[model samples]
Target: MSQPSQRPEFPVHLLSSPAMIEACRERDFARIFTLARRAGMHNSLIARLCDMTASRVGEVISGTRQLRDMAVIERVSDGLRIPGHMLGLARRDWESASADPTAPTVDIAPAASGLVPTLPGADLDSILAVAAGPKLSPSTVRALHSSIEDYWRRDDEHGGEVLRPAVVGQLRYVVDLIKETGEGEYRRNLYGVAAELARLTGWTYFDARQYSQARTYFTEALHLAKAVDDRPFMANVLACMSLQATYEERPADAVALSTAAQDCARRQGATPRVMSMLSMREAFAHASMSNRSAAHSALAEAHTCFERISDQDPDPAWVSYFDETKLIVDTGIARGRLGEAEAAEPLVEEALRREPRGNHRGRAFHSFWLARIQLQRGNLDQACDTAASSLELASVVESERVSGHLREFHQQLAPFRKEPAAVAFETQLRATLR
Candidate 1:
C-alpha cells in the first residue's frame, strides 16, 4: 500500500492540487470525490472503503451528495492510508504505525522458526522468495554437514590446492541447500553448516597463500555465521584472518583481528579448546611484532586455556584439530618468530614425534619450522637433513604455504652455499621443486 505522500494510484498528488486542497479545507466531499474519481479509484471501491453506498459515492462525485459525518471521513482517511492533516482530521492510528526512516535497520530478520538469512538491503521479492524453496529432510541436511568434516579430514593429510575446487563446490551446494530450506528450523541449521564450509573454503585458500581470495571467503564466512548469530564460528573466521595477517607481516592487523576473535570466543562461552586456539593466534601476532613479554603472556594464557579443556565441553568439529600436540607445535612457531629457536626447537620436535603419520601435511609444516630452528641454532648439517626430510614428507601435498616456509629456510642457507651440506640440500631442493 502506497503512503499518502505518493502519486495517482495513491492520490497524494491530487491532494496537492490547489483545487483539491481548497475542497479539503472547506470539508467539501463533493469536489474531493470528484478529484479522487479522476485519479483512477472507482466509485464502487471508494464506496466500500468509505463505508457508503455506490450510489452515495456516485452522487458525491456527481456533486449531488455531501459528506458531513466524522466517522465516514475517518474511514476515508484510513482506507486510502492518508495522513490525517491532509483530510482535516486528527492523525489516525494507522499513520502512527509507520516505521521511522531514521532508525538503523539490521540485515537480520527474526525467525518465526529460526532467523531468516538475508543480505543487507535485500529487495522484497528476494525475501519473499525465501519461502518458495523446497523443504529439505533432516537426513539431507545431516549429510551436507557430515561432508564438511570429511573435507577437513582430507585437507589435513593432503594440501588444499588440489582440494580447493571440491571444497568450493561443496560450499556452493550448501548455499543452495540454505536457499532451499525456506521456513523451517533447518534454515538456520543450514546457514550454520554453510558458515563452516565458507570458513573452510577460506582456510584452503589461506593454505595456498592466496591472501586476497582467502580474505574474501573469510568475510563471506563471517557474514554467514552472523546471519545465524553463530558467535563461535564468527570467532573462528576472525582467528583464521588473524593468522593470514600474521603471514603477510601485518602484525598490527593481526593483533587487532586476534583480539577481536578472543573477545568473541570468551563472550560466547566457547569451549576451552576454542579459547586456547584464539590465545595461540594472539601469541603469534605479538611474536610477529617482537613484543616478547606480551607474546609469552599470550602463550601462557593459551596453556591455561588448554588446561581448562574438559570432555564435557561442547567443542565444535572445526576445533577438533587443535589438540595438545598442535598446541605445542604452535607455541614453537610463535617462539621461533621472536628469535627463541633454542626454546622452540624441542617443543616442535616433541610434537613431530607425537603427531600421527597420517597427518603428513601438518607434519611437513612443522618439519620446516624444525629445520629453520636447527639453522638458527647453527647446526647447518642437521638443518639441511631436516629440510630435505620435510620436502619428502610434503612431496604428496600441494600447499604453497608449506613451500613458502621451505623457501624462507632456504634463504638462510645463502652464506653457507659453499658448504657440502648446503650443496647437497640445494641439489635435493631442485629435485623437489621440479
Candidate 2:
C-alpha cells in the first residue's frame, strides 16, 4: 500500500494526520486480540463485526491484514469494548485519499434569494395570534409537534412547500399554550416542545437557503432550551449552531461549538448515542479544516463508542434516531474528507439502505455526499444529477447546513456551466433559494 507521504500530487484536503496514523501503528496488536478474547466473541464473530471475511480478522490479528477501513476499526472497538472515537481516528489515519480532479470549478459566486414566498405581514400576525390563543391543551401542543415533524418529513421527500394553513394554525395553538402557561414544569415541557419545533424549523430554513431566518430560530431555540435548563437539548441547539458555523467555513468556530456540546452531553450524563453525535460534529469540523488527523481520530472514537451502546438503557427522546447505521453515515462523510471515496461510497450506500422512509433529510444528505463522490470519480453528469436531486429534496426544509452543501455543490459544478445538465440544475437551484 502507498503511504500518504509517497504521493506528492495528493490533494491536501484528503490528507489524514500523520501523527494520528502513527498512533494507530503503535497500538499493540496482541493487546487487542487479548481484549477480544475476553469479550467472548470468537474469531468468526469478530470478522463479522468488522465487515470482513472470517479469515480477514484472523489475518489482522496475526499481522497479515491491516486495520484500515472504518468498518474494521469499528469491529476491533466492538470486540474489545474500546471507545469508538479512538478507533475512528486510527482508521482515518489509514484510509486512502481521493479528490475530484474532474470537478467543475465554481466561482464561489454571491448567493441568490427568493425560493419560497415570504409569509405576508397580516398572515404572520394571524398565525402568531392563533399560536398565542387561550386554552390550548397539552394534547393539542403535542399534536402540533407531530404535525411539524410530518411536514418536515414531507418536505424532505417531495420538496419544499409552505406548511398548509391548517398546520400553521396548529402551531399557533401550541405557542399560545407556552405563552399563557408562563413558566413551570408544564411550561418547561412546553418550552422543550417549542425548542424542538424551532430547531427543526431552523434546520428547514437553512435547507431553503434562508440563512438569516435560520439563525433567528436557532438563537430563539437556544434561549428556550436554556430557560428550561435542559442540557441534552442544549447540546442539540449547539449542534445546530455548529452546523451553521461549518456552512460559513468557520471551521474553528464549528470545532468550539461541537466541543462545547460534547462537554454538555457529558455533564448531563448523556448516552453513547449523544456522545457519538457530539463526536461526529467535531469530526465534521476537523474535516472542514483539513486537519486529517483530528477528523479521523474523532471518527474512530465515534465508531468505538457506538459499538458499546447498551440495549437496556432507553435513549433520550431527542436523540433516539441515532443508531449504528447513522454512525456509518457520519463515518462515510469523514472518509470522503480524507480522500477515500472508494471506501466511503459503500458505507454511505449501506447507511441509506438501512435508513427508513420519512428520513427525507438523511436521504438528501446521502445524495449530496454521493454527488461529491461522483465528482471525484470524474462522472460529471451523474454528479450533476445527484446534486439536483439533493437540492430538490433539501429546498423545502429549513436547514442552513444542507443549503450550504448545495452551495458548495454548485461551486464544484461551476466549471461545467456549459453542460446542459449543469445549467438546468443551477436554474432549478436558484429558483428554490429563499
Candidate 3:
C-alpha cells in the first residue's frame, strides 16, 4: 500500500495575515518566502514544504527568483497548506466537501441566551431529515462555512447569477436546522451560518440589480445575525446595506448605515481589517455626499487601521478579501465618488496592476471605476480603453451591477457620441452585451 502523503501545516495566523493574503493574490513568490521565513520556518523547511530546492527558496526570498508555473504553485499551496482560492486555484482535495461530525468547530460566539432554539414541531422534519442529513453537528456546520467560502470564491470569479438558488436553498435548510436543534452552540452557530448565507443571498440579488429583493434579504440577514449577537457579521451586513444605499442615491441613509456599522464594530474587539473595511464604507458614504474633508478624513483613518494590522490579529474568513489591493481600489472608488478624478485614476490603476488573475468580477468592478475617473478627467481615449477593458472582464462575469456601471458610462458618452474613441467603445459594448 502507498504511504499517506506528508502534508505540513502552518499556523492559521501565518496563513491568514494581510501580507500573506496580498502576496498570495499577487503570486509574489519572493514575498511568500519572506513571510514564511519571518514566521520562523527555516529555509530548508520552507524548501521542503514548498517542494523547492533550498537554493531556490533562498533565491526567492532574496528576490532573485519567481515562481510562475502552475504545477509548482499547486505544490507550494498543498505543501504550505495554503487554501487554493487564495492562489486563484480551485478548492483543493484537502478541502473536504462532505460533512462529518468530527470536523473542527465552527467559530462563533456562543449564545448566552438560556433558552434553547427548537422548532415548534412539524411533519416537515421527517420529510427533510434525509436531505438535511445528520442533525446539525459541528462537522456539518463547518462544512456549511466551507461551502459559504466556496460560494464567495464563485461570486468573486463569476458573479452571483447562478449561485442565488443554491444559497437560498441552503439557507432554508439551515433555518430548519435551527428550528430542530435544541439550543447550545450547534444551534447558535447554525444561526450564524444562516445569517452568512442570507447575506450572500442578498449580495447576489444586489449583483443582479434586484434591489427590492436584495433589501429584503439583507434585512433578514441582520435579524438573524442579531439573534446570535454576531457583531462583526452584523456590521458586515450593515456595510452591505450602506453600499447599496450609495447606489440608490441615498447618501444620508448610507452615512447612517455606515456609522452604525462602525459603531457596532467598535463596541466589541474587532480586527483592524474589519475596522478598516467599515471605515472605507463611512468614507464612501461621505464621498457620495460630496463631503471632501470628511471623506478624506475617513480614508486616512482607514489607512491607519490597515497599518495597525499584525500577525496576532486573527481576521475572519469573510474579511480576508479586504487586503491591501482592495483597500487601494476602494479608496480610489471613494475618490471617484467625490469627483476627484485626478487623484483617483492612479490609485485604481496601481491596484489593478496588483490584482489577482482569477478575480474577474472584482477586476470588472474596479475597472469600471477607473474608466469613470478617466472620463471625468476628459481623457476620452484613455477612458474608452479602460471601459473597454472593463467590458471585456465583465463579459465573463455575470453581474448586472457591472452592466449597470457600463451603462452609466455609455450614458455619459452621449455628448461624445461622434468621437471615434467613444463610438468604438459604444459599438463594442452593444455588440458584447447584446
Candidate 4:
C-alpha cells in the first residue's frame, strides 16, 4: 500500500451526534455510485473492494443477484451509502447468523452506553446505509475514530457486569471503517485498540467459564495483531492465551506459548516494560508446569528488566500495567504458587502497599494473591477474609481471570471443608463458575 495522505483534520468530539448517523443512513445510492465513479473505482475495483467477482457486483446493482452472501451484503452496504457503524452492525448480525443460523438475532439499538452521546437508531442506520453505498467522507472517518476512542475510555461497572454492548457496537463500526478506508496507519493504531478490547472480551467470557468463546476472541485478536504487524502486541495476545491455557490446566501448552512470547519480544527488541511483562507471564507458565527453578529465573529476569527500562518509544498498550509494584505482586504470586509461603507473603504485602490508590481492579488482584499466600501459610481465616475482599472487587470488573484466581483460592480452602467460611466462599465461587 502507498503512504496514506495527511488525513483532513476534523473535530472528533462533534461526531457523536445522532444527526450525522441519520444523514448517512438516508444516503442515496445514485449519489454513492457517482461518488465511487468520481473516485475512479471501476466495477472490477469495486468487486475487489467487496471481495466479490466483478460480475457479481454488476448483478447486484442490476437487481439480478440476490446478494445472499452477508459478505456481499456488507459490500453492497459499502457500495451504497450506509454509515460505517450501521454497516458494521449489519455485517456482524449477518456473520453471527452465518456462524449459527439458530442463534437469536438482536435488533440494532445504538444507545450511548459510553461517554459519547448515543446516536438514534434511525440515524445510525442511515449513516451505515450511506457509508456502505458510497465512498465515505473524511468527516465520517474522523467521527468513527472519535466514537471508538470514547468507547475505549468508557467504564460501566454494575455489581460485576460491564454492560458494554454499545462499546462493542462502536468498535465494530471502527473495524468496518478501517477495512473500507484502506488507511494503513489508522488501521494499525485501531488494531492495537481492537486487540485490547478483544482480550478484555475474552477475559470476560473466561470469567463466565465460556472457554470456547474466550478462546475464539483471543484467536481473533492474534489475527488482528498479525494484520497490523505488531509483534509485541501479538506477544501480549499469546501471553493472554497462555493464561487461558493455564486456567484450563494445560500447563505444557501454556509454557510453550509463554516461551514463544518471550522469544518474540527478544527478537523484536521490545521495550524493557514490555519484555518484563512477558517475563512475568513466562514465570506464571513455569509455575503452572511445576518448574520452580525456571519460574524463579523468569521472575529474576523480569525484575532486571524493570531496572533496565530507559527512555524509548511508548510501551505497548497491553503491557502498560507492568510497573515495578505490579511485577513484585506477580513475582509474589509465582512464589506462592511454588509453595514458598514465607518468601511470598512479605513480598506480596510490600507490593500491595505500592499498588496505586483507586485501582480497584489491581487492589482486588493483590488481595487474591494475598489470599493465596495465606492459604499456603495455613492461615485459613486470613485467606478467607482476603478471598472475600477479592471477590468483592472481582464482582465489579467482569474479569474471568479474576474469577479463576478466586476459584483457585476456593479450591485451596476446600481442605477446610468443615469450616463455615470455607464452605460459604466455595459455594459462592462455584455459583459463578461456568
Candidate 5:
C-alpha cells in the first residue's frame, strides 16, 4: 500500500489559552471556531486537528452537536492548541511538554471553583464599585430581578448546561450587592434575590452532577436566606438540599432536610403549593428509604396540599413550576422508586402527555420512569420502545440528570439483552451517547 502524507502540525506555541478551555467547557463552540479561524485554521484543519470527521466539525461549529466526550475534548485541546485543564480535563501531555520546566503546574480542578471567575465584560473591582455606590434605584433592582427570572425560564426550556456560567456570574454580582448594601428593605430584598439566585445556580450545578459545588452553593443560599429572615426562602433552600440528598441516595439526610423544610414552611405560613413541594420531597425520601407506609402518607399529604391550591391564589415565582402536572410526575417517580410499577405507569404517561414539547429534559425524565415501570412489569418490548423515545429526547437536552437516567434505563435492559427490541434499543442508545 502506498503511504499517505501526513499533514503539517500547527505551531504548538499557537495553542489556545485557559480561556479557550473555559469556553469549550461552557459549550461555547462559536468562540472556539472563531478563535481557530482567526488563527488561520479552516474546518478541514480543525477536523484534522481534533481527529473528527469534517462534517462532525461543521456540526459542532454550528451548535448542532456538542463536544462532551472526554476523548473528543482532549483531541480538541490538542488540535486547537488549547490546555486540557480549561475543559476540566486532566493536563494533556502536549500542555506539559509545551510548558517551561521552571513554571509551577496548575492543578486542574472542577470548573465550579470556590471563586467565581470574572465574566467577560465584568470585573470584580467594577462590580464592587457599583455595589458600594449609593443605594441602587428600585428600577435597577427590578431589572436585575427580571433578568434572573428570564434566565430561570430559559433554563426550563434549555437545560442548565448552557446557563450555568451566566447564573453563577449573576449570583456573584447579587451577593456583592447584598454585602455592600446597608440595612434596609432594599437590602433585605437584595438578600432574598441573592438567595434565590444562589439556589438556582446550585440547581444547575446539581443537574450537572457537580455535587461538591452544588452543596457549596446550596449552603450559601441557605445562609443568605437566613440572614434576611426569609423563612419561605429558607424552607425552599432546605427542600432543594433535600432533593440533592435524594438524588445522592442519602435517604436519611433527604428525610431530615425535607422534614425541616416542612416545619419551616408551616411556621412561616407558606403557600399550600410550597407545602406540597416539601411533602413531595418527603415522599421521595421515604421511598428511597424503602418505607412504603411513610412514603404513601407523605404522598397523600402532597396530594391534599396540591388540591387546596386555587388558581387565583398567590404563588411565589419560584414555586409556580409545581403545578398539577409536576405533582403527578413526582408522585409517579416516588411510586416508581418504591417498585410500584403498576401504579406508576398511568401517572407517568399522563405527565408525559401533558409535558410541554419545549421541556425536552422533563419529557426525557418522565419517559425514562415510564420505561422503567414497563421493564419492571416484564414488558420488554414496550420498555425498549419507551426507553428509545427517552433516549432520543435525552440526546437533545444538555442535562446530566437526563443522561444519568438514560444510563440507568440502559442498565435495566440488561436482563432482556437477548431480545430483539433490547438489541435495537441498545444500538440506538450507544449511538446517541456517542
Candidate 6:
C-alpha cells in the first residue's frame, strides 16, 4: 500500500485567543482545526486532542461534516478544555450525573443569537486586537465572503440547527474585521457581506423557531444593508421578514412588509428573480388575508416576472436560489392557504418531483402541503399515506418548521381518528416523536 501523504505545518502564533474562544463557543470544529493547523499543530495532534481519527478531523476541516451531536460536543469540550457556555451545554457534571438512575434531565437551550454584546469602542478595539491580531487584506475579505456563501449553500441542504452557530461565528468575526480597517471598495464589500450574513443568521433563527431573535437580526440586517446602499439585499431581507409574519399568521404585517419589498425591488431595478420572489410573498400575504382576487393577481404578476428571468440576468448571490421550482412551490402554497385545493395539488406535486433528494427539508415541506391538499379533497387514505411519508422525511431533519408542518398534519387527521389509516399514521407519528 502507498504511504499516506504528510500534512504541512502551520505557525502556532496565528491561532489567536479570540479565534479559539469563538470557535469553541460555536462548537465549530472546522474553524478550530484550521486555527490549530495555523498554530503549527498537526492533524495527528489535533485528532489526539479531540479524541478522534485523523480522517474525521480532516472531514470537519473540509466542511464535509459537522459536530452537532451533544455527546460528541461534550467529549470534544472536555478534551479541549472548552468552556461550558461556549458549547451551549450543561455543566460537565451533568453528564456524570446521568449515570445515576434518578438523575434529572438537563435542558440546555441552543446557543444564544451569537451576537456579541456591544462594548465601548476602546475596550472592543483592545479585545479584537488580541483575537484578530492584524488588519485583514482585501483577499482575506474576499475569502470570508466566499465562506459566507458556502454557509448559505450548506444551510439550504442541512437546515438551520446544524449551521447556525458557525455562520453566526463568521458574522461576529467579520464585524470585528470591519472595526479594524477598510475603505472605498473594500469597505463597501465588507459591509455588504456583513449585511448578507446578518440576514442569513436571521433566516436560520426563523427556521429554528426563535422568532424574537430572528426579528432582531432581520432588523439589524436591514439597517446594515441600507447603510451600504445595497437595495436589492435590503429588499430580500424585507421579503424574509414578510415570510416570517405570514408564518405567524400576521397577514397585515406580512402584506405591509411584502409590499415594501416590492417597492424597493422596483426602485432598484432588481433582477426578475428578486421581483418574482417579492411578488410571491405578497401573494401569500393576500391569500392569508382571504383576499382571493388580490392573491390571484399577485400570483399572476409573480409568474410574469419569473418568466422574464434568464441565465444572463444580473441576479444577486442572495437571490440565486429563487428559480422556477421555488416559484412553483410558493405559488402552490399560496393557493393552498386560500383553500384552492384543486389548483394547488398538481403544482405542489410537480414541485415535489422537481425537488432534489438531497433537499430533505424542502421535500418534507412540499410533501406536507400535498398531504393537506389530499385531506381537503376528502381523500383520507391518500392524505394519511402522504403525511406519513412527509413525517418520515421530517424525522431525519432538524427543522422546527418541518416539525410544525407535521403537527398541523396531525391536527388535520383528528377528524378521521376512526379510520384505520389515520390511526396507523398517528401511531407512526407518535413513535417518531418519542
Tell me, by lDDT, which candidate is best: 3
TM-score of each: 0.69, 0.61, 0.70, 0.63, 0.72, 0.70
Candidate 5, residues 38-68: lDDT per residue as tens digits? Answer: 6677888888778888888788778787665
Which candidate number has the best TM-score?
A: 5
lDDT of 6: 0.75
- lDDT by residue for model 3 over 7-124, one digit each (tens)? 5566677776789889998989788877877877888998887778999898888888766545577788778877665775434446442321222222222334523232111112
lDDT of 6 by residue, 228-289 (tens): 78888888999999999988779999999999998887888998889998999899999999
Give the per-residue Cα lDDT of candidate 2 at 261.
87
Predictions ranked by lDDT, top down? 3, 1, 5, 6, 2, 4
Clashes of 6: 2
TM-score of 4: 0.63
> What local distance difference test score does each model get?
0.77, 0.64, 0.81, 0.63, 0.76, 0.75
Candidate 2 regions exceeding 4 Å error are: 1-123, 128-133, 136-141, 158-161, 164-172, 182-184, 357-361, 379-434
Model 3 residue pairs with clashes: 119-179
Give the winner by TM-score: 1 or 5: 5
Model 1, range 162-280, lDDT digits (tens) per residue? 66656655565556566545755887888888788778877876886656556767887898888877898899999999999988879999999999998987777899999999999
State, as a TM-score between 0 and 1, how close model 1 is to the true structure: 0.69
- Candidate 4, poorest ten consecutive residues by summed lDDT: 114-123
Model 5 lDDT, residue 195, Cα: 80
In model 1, what is the error at residue 217, expressed in angstroms? Answer: 0.4
Q: Candidate 2: what lDDT?
A: 0.64
Count of steric clashes across candidates, in order? 0, 36, 1, 29, 2, 2
Estimate, for each residue in 98-174, the C-alpha lDDT of model 4 and write its tens digit. 33232234343332222112221211222233354434555655665455444333332331125235444444554
